[model samples]
Target: MDIGYILSGFAVGFLVGITGVGGGSLMTPLLVFLFGFKPIVAVGTDLLFAALTKTGGVWVHHGKHKSVDWKVVGLMATGSLPVSAVTIYIIKHLMSVGKEITGLITFALGIALILTACALLVRSLLLRKHEREVESSSISTGRFQGTTQIALTIATGAILGALVTLSSVGAGALGTIAILLLYPKMSTLKVVGTDLAHAIPLTAIAGIGHWSLGHVDFGLLGSLLIGSLPGIWIGSHLSARIPEKILRPILATLLLLIGLKFVLA
Candidate 1:
């Protein structure tokens, strides 16, 4: 057993717990840059790692009634599932052409990571704005509804599916931002819940597809899981004691650095 890989996994899991971002954004890049794994293998292994880790989170959230928006989840799945299938087909074709698909995927992952970071930063700003607006005005007791919202949700889901399938990024922070933007009236907890619910199946399906294509490294994934499971538990237990003001900026800085590294590599 490679203790280094396990320790890396623990570090990534701790970040995920601290930020609520998926492991792929951090894990895939770490594998590629720090461990010198091929980009394709890093992405494939991280997808499986994300699917497994998020499945447990989804279950816990469901048990607590705090992690799902079934209708929104269904809509996202409807759009994302087909897009994911198409993305895998395209990746397989690129692989068949003997192209440097890993480089392309890495580049795409870097771009996606940067975009997710921006989305997170913007979301924080928007939430602050919304809170201020609410403080100045009476709160409305209405839910968002309209063709525009539905269409936007579907479009966001499609984009997430393609990005995630190609780079294993964008489905966590990016997805949540889409939800928050589309339905500002909804509680933040609900938005996160719905996003997680939708991401579980989407990542699982994509991960399985990558596995079938022989992209995933089972040993690496196992090693990651061995460390991440306990790390997540510990992080979650300690989360409330930590201050978000410090965490967000640090996470954003990490994402920015990793994104730049991947893009410039």
Candidate 2:
């Protein structure tokens, strides 16, 4: 029943609704810096939070647009799921060795936040560049094919799997960017849908793994969900009125500063 945590979740959800940024990029840091939660707990809680919140998006994408590419999702899952399990095993071993793992988690979280910030800043530019390339090349209907593209897509998923498991960030924004780059011909809707589809399982498994390690805080997770669900609904309704061009840079800058703080700490 912490009102502060509820409000924090609302704010993060509101921003995410408008910007389409992932909650982990915002919530994990908030839990650590604002609430003084351990990095491992914050990350674990946020992973389940992310998985639950994003579940709605998957159904929306599937029912309305059918934009999700199952093949790509399957390919990514092939790489991500095994790595996620392996990451959990490694973390458990580290903990058993009486090694300090919070520092590692904090470092990974910081790095992920910085990467997400850069992704947000450059997303529009990258899309524009992609459009230009498409126009110049007259390429239409870009789809994933060939052994190299398949390998790269799987590799991207593996990287994201490890990154998300460690930091509870990256499965959203970073995943989208990697998929967009790999499948340049995909529509934005498809890219988002595919990424989100992949993220559900990734976050769920990672969250469960963290829960098994006793890193997740259910009370905190409940408080966050209480506010975030409504906040996301309201924010999505209001998103059309916001100027994304102005908002993204400011958010990116905020993330950059926060990332530096965590990295330095």
Candidate 3:
């Protein structure tokens, strides 16, 4: 029922619908800096918020565009799901032993935000470089690289799993950039779809784990969803009309500044 929370959610959701990033990267920081929530609670609440908001995106991409690459999703999930569970277990154990982890979580969130900003800034350059590398490779080398890329994808998933569970900030911009770097041949649509598809279960599991640790704020979650759902719907419809070249750099700059504040605070 807090209008400020609702407005913040709508803003984040609108940006996410347009750029396919910013859910956790923006929301977690807002919760911490603006609303004065603890880092753990902010991350935990944002995880479920991200999961629910992105479900509609998966449906649109899979049903209408058929852009989801299930094989890649399965491979990524193979690594991410287990690691996510283990991360939750470790955090739970630490908290049970009376460890004070608020500062740790804040630092982790700051690092993740910084990485996400860097990923956003370099996304196009990374893709172009990947394409050049692909073009220069020999056929035999290509086959070997395929096998390697699969392993790399799973490894990337494991990294995301740990990062997302700890901070709720890596599964959007960071995930998309990692997918593009690994699968340079994939179309943007496929990369977005696959990333979103993988994010659903990862966030769900992580959110549930945080819930068990009493980190989630259901009231905040509900308020966010109320405005975000509509915001996403509107923003998606307008995305194609927007110039991403203009938007991304601005968004990236904002994330970078917020990240630095968290890290230095």
Candidate 4:
């Protein structure tokens, strides 16, 4: 593994563990803006990275007996998976025909980044309103059987699938926030756990699609993974000790700047 890639993996992994917002939001952008990866390649690689990294989280949560609302995850996947498949098919077709899609990918990435920044800011606001939850960890769920809510949940999943496939910048903070808005009564621990669980299949499917399209770089993926494992462990431990009041704003600002650079470039 390249030392630089390992370092990047560790940094991004730790941030994701600590802030719950870095897997795609930070890593994809870093690949594009910092490491000069093509937008499509960066997104594709990061999608796999997210899948691999979060798989471990799922195991840990299960081992700890943390609650995961399988019904909700199923509902969301019903919408996300099919849409993701179609999106990748379209992308692969375009690529096969030598279509000029860079503009499309770049534009999508830029928009996704901006949206991620907004989501991060919104999470901070939500946490501020619920002061006691600022340091709370884990995710759990409550009942929501309303037809409207179910439809909305599926719709959210569809949107998430499309966005993540195109930009690799959702299913992390964005998905969690969507879950929170949909089920405010659910346990925060469940919400996060569910989100994390859903992300793995969602990203893994999308990553496989990208791989078929030849957008994934396995060498780079290996390097990033090497560092991310340790980074995430460290970040999870450091989270309770760190002040959100300091970290949130800084991360938000960084996202905003990077997003603007992409869109306005």
Top-scoring candidate (TM-score): 2
lDDT of 4 at 202: 94
lDDT of 4 by residue, 1-265 (tens): 6898899999998887788776888888888867898999998999998898888887776568465667778989999999999999999889879998778887787888788888888987875565223222212322355687788889999999999999898788889888878777656677778888999999999999999888999999999999999999999999999886787778888887887888887
TM-score of 1: 0.91
Tens digit per residue, CA lDDT, model 1, 34-123: 888888888888888888899887877777865466777887888898899898888888878986687788788889889877877777
Count clashing residue pairs in model 4: 7
Candidate 2 per-residue C-alpha lDDT over 205-262 given as tens digits, one digit per residue, 9 for 90 to 100: 9999999999999999999999999889988888899998889899889888888888
Please, what's the RMSD in Å of model 4? 3.3
Cα-based lDDT for every prediction: 0.80, 0.88, 0.86, 0.83
Evaluated against the true structure, the overall lDDT of model 3 is 0.86
lDDT of 3 by residue, 1-265 (tens): 8999999989888988787788899999999889999999999999999899888889998999888878778878888999999999999999889999887888888899999999998885665465433222222232237768678878989999999999999998888887776666676677788899999999999999999999999999999999899888888888999988789889999999998888898
After superposition of all CA atoms, the RMSD between model 3 and the true structure is: 3.4
TM-score of each: 0.91, 0.94, 0.92, 0.92
Score residue 219 of candidate 4 by CA lDDT.
Answer: 96
Clashes by residue pair, model 2: none
Model 3's number of clashes is 0
Instruction: Superpose all Cα atoms of candidate 1 onto the true structure and report the RMSD in Å to 1 decimal.
Output: 3.5
Q: Which scores higher on TM-score, 1 or 4?
A: 4
- The regions of model 3 sitting more than 4 angstroms off are 126-147
Best candidate (score: lDDT):
2
